[model samples]
Target: MHKALRLTALAGLFMAAIAQAATPIDVYRDPNCGCCKSWIKYLEANGFSVNDHVEPNMSALKQRLGVAPRLASCHTAVIGGQFVEGHVPVAQIRDLEKHPELAGIAVPGMPAGSPGMQTGQVHQAYQVIGLTRDGADRVLASYPADSSL
Candidate 1:
């Protein structure tokens, strides 16, 4: 009975490792960008296995990924065949699976309190903009300022 229990625990651990390995996302950022590193750490903590790529010309990469200048941020991530720009929250990132109409999502500028951009308890109002397949932009989610100051 004890042997069977040990085998079950081992199988569970093995499956857990495979699950972790399966949630891979590719992140592109400048090597000197500290916030980008923080964001990578945040993603890993949230169960994403990040493949960090340091790019010399971020503008070119963004352009290739169809990220418009107005929707630009410090870093870009590719997951679920969609581009994720800036410090978007994990919830929205995960929600990308449900929205096949969207080409990608962006947080625009790095707003304080967003995932990797957290500043203590302080957070700023921000919107997660989704770029549609037809090239129109829409608000997928909005985060209001933290009022519990």
Candidate 2:
């Protein structure tokens, strides 16, 4: 009976850990930016619990959060202690959550076919950039064509 109880407790603990693994995103953007609003909506649609914060100076907010220029975008977000820039796909965010060692993920400038920025059938190859606090950056993932979704 004791062994059975222990096994149940372990199972409960594992379930709790899975629940806690969902990514929590805090998005900072300019109040007047329509694209930023769309980005938040995109995140919500993709399973991230987004906490939106509108700021007068998004540039300052980005700087405060240590976002690099190469990763700059219309808005910024922090998730699990990592910065997320621009219209980053939710899949990449999930990938980041799985790999906790990554400093951050970014989509750089808004591409025409990116999540919230999707317009027409035009598609472009883009990179999800990973960056350190000191501004060191690298390509975390590359998406090609309009079918990247």
Candidate 3:
């Protein structure tokens, strides 16, 4: 009986952890941009709960958010205290969610082969950038351009 009780308690703890592990995102983007909406939908499909805000001045928003010009994109997302820019992959977002110590991850620009911007036969190599609060950026990972995927 004690063993069963302990197992039940452990399972309850695991469930609570999973329930609290979900990432909440706040996205800022152009009001009429379809790609940004599609990206948000992709995030939603990947288990993120998004709060979206449409803004006319995405450039100003980026500036205010401290996103470097080189890392700028069509939309910006704040997730788990990190800033996610552009059409970053859902896996990368999940990585950021798992590692809360990093500042954020960004895709810089809209690469042709990104998740939401997949083209029929056009693909471009791109890097996901990890940013620091002091404006330092590092390449987190490089994803090959795979439009054929």
TM-score of each: 0.88, 0.76, 0.77
lDDT for 111 in candidate 3 is 88
- Which candidate number maximizes TM-score? 1
Clashes of each: 0, 0, 0
Model 1, range 1-149, lDDT digits (tens) per residue? 99999999999999988786767899999989989999999999888999999999999999998998999999999998899999988999999989999989999998988888985788899999999988899999999999987
Ranking by TM-score: 1, 3, 2
Backbone clash total for model 3 is 0
Predicted candidate 2 versus true structure: per-residue lDDT over 1-149, tens digit per residue: 99999999999999888657645789988888888888888887766678889888988888887777767989888988888889888878877876665668889898878888876777888889887556577787788876645
Residue lDDT tens for model 3, 57-128:
988878877788888888999876678899998878878866555667789888886877864567899999
Q: Select the stronger candidate by lDDT from 1 and 2.
A: 1
The per-residue C-alpha lDDT of model 3 at residue 43 equals 84
How does model 1 fare in lDDT?
Answer: 0.93
Q: List the residue pairs that clash in candidate 3.
A: none
**Candidate 2, run of 10 with poorest lDDT:** 15-24
Show where candidate 2 strays beyond 4 Å: 1-22, 147-149
RMSD of 2: 5.9
